[model samples]
Target: MTFEDTWKPKIDAYRAKLDEEVGPYKALVEGIDYSSENFNAVEALDTLLTEKDREITNSTAKQLVAKQRDGTLTAVEIYNAFAKRGAIAHIFTNCAMELFFQEGLERAKELDKYREDHNGELVGPFHGLPISLKELMKYGGKVTTAGFVCYLDNYISNSPREESVSIQILRKLGAVFYMRTAQPQSVMHLDTDNAITGRTSNPFNRKISPGGSSGGESAAVAMGSSVFGIGSDIGGSIRVPAAFCGLYGIRPTTKRVSGLGSLSGGAGQESIFSSQGPLTRTIDDLEYYMVNYINMGKPWEYDPNTIPLEWKTGVSLPETVTYGILLTDTLVEPSDAIKRGLAYVQDKLRDYKGKKVDVKVITIDHDLMKEAFKQTLQIYGTSKPVHDKLFAISNEPLLPLTKFFLGFANPEENDILTNNNIKEQFKYYMYYLFKDQGIDFLISPTNPNVGEVPKNLTHWNYSSMFNLIDFPNIIFRTGLTFDPKVDVKGPTNVTDYNANDYVNAPINLQLTALRFEDEKLVEGVKLLDKALELA
Candidate 1:
């Protein structure tokens, strides 16, 4: 009885089986018996960290439509202060999968009757704001359950899309698709969970983890419950839940946001690629919706598999840059709150903009980048209709980290024929680390523990090594703050993740860019997100 008294009764019988599967969905999603009447909510939020019109809940659907056309606010009181702070953030972070608060009260009374019959604005720039998505895109009549259950009787399809091009380019830029999220049964796990929404935690620390196949839209826009969303990424599933629930995501590159009618666990193993972007909480709302909603919704002349190269915002580098830190890794080492949040972004790029930055914490010879990120997640779970519908979803019981990694996912069925020889050694180690290391983008430590615990996300192999170097990464948050007395453990660390016991978890702050350089990683992290005021 000694391995912490043998996993403390298997962590107290899975903490009473996750409080009998989250105690009746936390009393039917947080009206928790209206706490015996007149329940005041707008107050239950601060935990996800401040807001409800004190602004900056990572604003930016073009700065909430330019403060609802400069009357300073009121698209129905910013839609009743983000729907009363996203209804107490889905009643304390279950981070909903589809609630649409009665369709956000009929789209905030039709945007307050078109701002009271056009005496003012909003018919674009995400008008009323509020965002969220990650259930493999496509909404109208929404239902995409990527977390499998035979697509939970799959929905979405409103006659139109005469052959969808990201739903007619985000419906000609209006951008207001309410809900559709939750994944990880055979979306091939990063963390979410299935059988109808299981995991998705880390609204800061509901015992860790939020990252996954876009962990329920990175825990619904990191608990501000959708100030932005829409995700997809092959391995680092959109920067692993935006670096385990801190928030910002990007994962652009591949096709620069356009997977036409998305949906992909493995729909056509299509060259270890996979993209589709956005998961915000602002880096100016991920470059104002990837430069006015996916580069002015060009979508490569309507998805000929986009990439006619559009979104190239004004990037003025050369203030003396040369980043390439990996904050400890002899196979992994991040956790003194992500090595002091990557040393607070290398001292805000060398003392809050004096510039001349150049970190090189190198040393990741993961012996072939860890077998090319486990053969690119075995050719990304080579879809067979999500492993034959997770054994017809119902038999419950497989989460001990999904029998610690697909429990022989039926005796390792030839690990998807060596995922194309590990995708040519992960595209020749991303052309030998970006054209033989001229070093422009490669900062590490996005995972090795930052958000975990709930079913313990077994060290999400450092953001799946940028999905085996397919690049295009960004997950900002590093507004660092988790002080266990300046984060412990050091005694001459000889690596091997400095004696791992879950790489010391505790997060917030993770950035990675290049390969379609997310508009210079959102203008070098919005100048350290305005010197760490974070938005």
Candidate 2:
């Protein structure tokens, strides 16, 4: 059969399966208007819930777990609330690739039974917490699409069902997974879109991107669909979306979280490896997932690439902290909104300096960032062959973003030697730069601009440089947005992509620490988060 003929049935079957899965929840959404242009997922879901249900769905994973353990809320109630809300989020944003609310509800019931049988004992750290999975993570018996139409029929495992190590950890911790979020076709773009699931719009403003390939996760969490969700990043997949969606996300140093059993078009090309981390509305939830995933999950035992490091809790920063402010990376100057957000934080830090926190700012040249951005593209180019093969199988036309990425490196070049040399040299430069400055962490714009309109995202240097150097980075919302009246175009244009008014788009900043300093990065972010009143 022709590839198109073979792929057509698979696509139809996948849609049919989604229809069947969502069938049980149809009645729950009967009163809701899915087609309303005025529909806001967060507002609609909040209105749908009782005051008590709203409180349960809006609580952080840590808060939910505590309530469940104390018998204040049942597992079934928590799961149902999130599941129904998740359905609403999907309706508004097209964020879900798969929905298994019935299965998730059953799992919640089992957890409740365990709690009752054991005198209100909990299953694990994440007991009764409703979490969403990125499309890349493998869930047993579920189709692992990875946003590729070619893999629509590819069930997670053929024999004894297997889940990704991260998913297994979450399941053991009593995380009920009702939905798998969407991603871009190649899982490489900054916005989520694919042949199977279409485009996932920003929940904040439908015109802009939610940020991908983890866009779905950010949108869902931002819309209160899930308390927390897993998102993977090679470039700015996790951080950009988190920033754009007014949420918190971390891109830990590579391999900190297990990638085993996860699907990626860039699989096996480790010039720059992807890392998995949590996307949440609050900073504490980000820490909650990291601490438990490291200490309780024991990732190293399952994934060979994971480093065997215990998660350090109670991380305390010094009384005085130094922050290196990077206004621009040289490749692209940030938009006025982002610049204003940076200045706002800097002003706040200066005000609080020497009293409760010691704050210092060091501005560094962006020559290294320019080189790192170029080299990171070369590293990403190594995965073209893998992507080419996948696309060839389904005879699918390449998306614009895919075409742009594939043109980054010469296919004939031996990427291993060249990319590694570039990485090493960049690392050396950063080591001395941080040493000379004696800064705790470097802060910059997470993206050159706020969230982009779909298909217009091009410059990734702001976040990709850290990926090139393998530093631990986090993106936190600045609690600011673009004011069209105030933020107008400056005389010098810094970006080549089309610029928009960016009305109501969230502005966020990136913070980074040295490699293997993931714990310090989180602690530093918390301090800055407080100073900026980000919570």
The most accurate candidate by TM-score is 2
Query: Pick by lDDT: which candidate is best?
Result: 2
lDDT of model 2, residue 187: 93
Q: Write the per-residue lDDT of candidate 2 for residues 1-535, one digit (tens) a residue.
A: 4656788777777778777776765676677665543244565566666787688877878789888888888999898788877877887788889988878989999999999999988989988888899988988877898988778777876332367888888888788888899999999998888888678888767778899889999999998888788999999999999988888899999988987888988888878889899999888899989999899989998887799998887777766688888887766667777889889888887886434554466655577566567778888988888888888889876778878877887667646787788788888888788888778888888877787776667888778888887899998877787777767752123434333436667888889999888899988888787777764
Q: Candidates' TM-scores?
A: 0.32, 0.94
Instruction: Please report, in order, the local distance difference test score of every candidate based on alpha carbons.
Output: 0.61, 0.81
What's the lDDT for candidate 1?
Answer: 0.61
Candidate 2 lDDT (Cα, whole model)? 0.81
Off by over 4 Å in 1: 1-59, 69-105, 110-127, 136-144, 147-149, 154-227, 232-234, 239-282, 286-322, 325-354, 359-372, 375-386, 391-463, 466-524, 527-535
Clashes by residue pair, model 1? 209-451, 209-452, 478-509
- The TM-score between candidate 1 and the true structure equals 0.32
